[model samples]
Target: MFRYFLNRLGQGVIVLLVLFTITFFLVHALPAGPFQTEKAIPEHIKERMEAYYGLDKPLGVQYVKRLGTLGTADLGASLRLEGRDVSEIISQAFPVSLQLGLVAMGLAICIGIPLGVVAAWKKNTILDYSAMALAMIGICIPAFVIGPVLADRFGQQWQALPAMGWSPLSPSYWLLPAFTLGLVSAAYLSRLTRAGMLETLNQDFVRTARAKGVPEGQILVRHCLRGGLIPAVAYIGPAFAGIISGSLVIESVFAIPGLGTHFVKAIEFGDEPVLTGIGLLFGILIILANIGTDILGAWLNPRLRSSR
Candidate 1:
């Protein structure tokens, strides 16, 4: 188990390096200069601005310099935002994205796992059909549409919750955004979990447990569940990649100040530092999520646990 974890961790590091390298070059390759706008600035002004931000340096020198800063965990200065560092902006914004993602995934897990269990337990029944129907609806609907509809029903018409804006003190602010993100994730999880649980429940171990006179609940939760939930757990890593991408739309709709919002703005302005920083930050998160998923899968499967 320990050896497997170390292997995963090593692979994660390699993935991060590749991600960072790609982000660096891609951002630099944009056609629009970071300091340029619709109206052209004076040549001298542009040169001074470029030099000020060290854009005057050769690409190799700039990459090496940025790489050095990255080694020290500095994300360099934001070319689009005056007197701001990408690291500073992200430090302020990421907590909001993190909170939103966690709540969204929590909702997915809570709703998806049980719904899947019951659906698998009573396969092909009305309950199974209904649950899958809802899951399909969720998967079909885009978050952009859902956010507005939810805001209207709950915030505008019903007056039960705030429509937009965010505050750590208010759980109400998180609901629409979190739900918008979670609903799609829940749909995927339900499908995956149901499939995994259905397979595990029919396996030899489950049959042996039943033959041993194990209580149905005990067999379902203790023996089969660990194996069943592995897919759901593995899904979390990719699910978060979706969740964060979804948050891009959700953040704009709900006026949430998060890394997603910055991410969108960075692209619009071609803010290299901000774009690279947020990209790598997201890359790190997804990498870590995947590593965690691998570790969890190993824990649930003895065959994996015994392997390096």
Candidate 2:
């Protein structure tokens, strides 16, 4: 297990390195510098700004210099936000994004799993159809559309929640955004879970358990559930990472101050440090989530454990 973990970690590091390399090259290759929009500024001032940012150096030199700061607190100053260090900005913003992501993931799991279970248990019934129908609607609707609809219904029309802005102290700020972020995930999970459960329930072991007079509840909970949940478990890690990265849209809708807001802005302004910092941070999250899921999968399946 220890050796497997180390191997996964090494692979994760390589993935991050590749992600950063691609991001670095793409951003650097953009036609204009951060100061390019300042048309009224003197040529000497632009030259000085370029030199100050080490943009005057050869691409190779700049790449080497930037590589030296990987995994460190020094992410350089923000081109868009003067006097602000990129690392500091990330530290402040990421927690909010992480919190939102976690909540959204929780909602997805809590809602999706039960819907799936019921759909599977009642396979051909009205209840099953209803649950699956709901899941389909959720899957069809995008988060951007859902966000506004939720805000309009729950916030503006109903006056039950805040329409925009974020506050760590108030759970109200989280509701609309969390739901919008989670809805589609919940929909996907529901279908995955139902499929897994149906497959597991059809297995010979389930029949054997039933023949031995194992209680239906016991079979469902202990035997079926364990096997039934495999696909859902595997989907969870990448799903959570998707939820986090996908928050960029929700953040814009809710006006929540998180990494997503800065992420979009970084591209608009060519803020390299912020973009790279966020890229690496999100890469770490995605990599760690996948590793954790692999560990969980190993624990669940003897085949996976032995293979690892």
* Overall lDDT per candidate, in order of appearance: 0.87, 0.90
What tens-digit string does per-residue lDDT give for candidate 1 at 244-263?
76687799998999987888
Worst 10 residues of 1 by lDDT: 299-308
Q: Which pairs of residues clash in candidate 1, taking residues 3 or more apart in a chain or in different chains?
A: none
Predicted structure 2: lDDT: 0.90
Against the true structure, candidate 2 reaches a TM-score of 0.95
* lDDT digits (tens) for residues 189-254 of candidate 2: 999999999999999999999999999889989998888888889999999999999998799988
User: Pick by TM-score: which candidate is best?
Assistant: 2
Candidate 1, residue 158: lDDT: 100
Superposed model 1: Cα runs more than 4 Å off? 208-215
Query: Can you tell me which runs of candidate 2 are displaced by over 4 Å?
Result: 71-73
lDDT of model 1 at position 9: 76
- Candidate 2 at residue 168, lDDT? 86
Best candidate, lDDT: 2
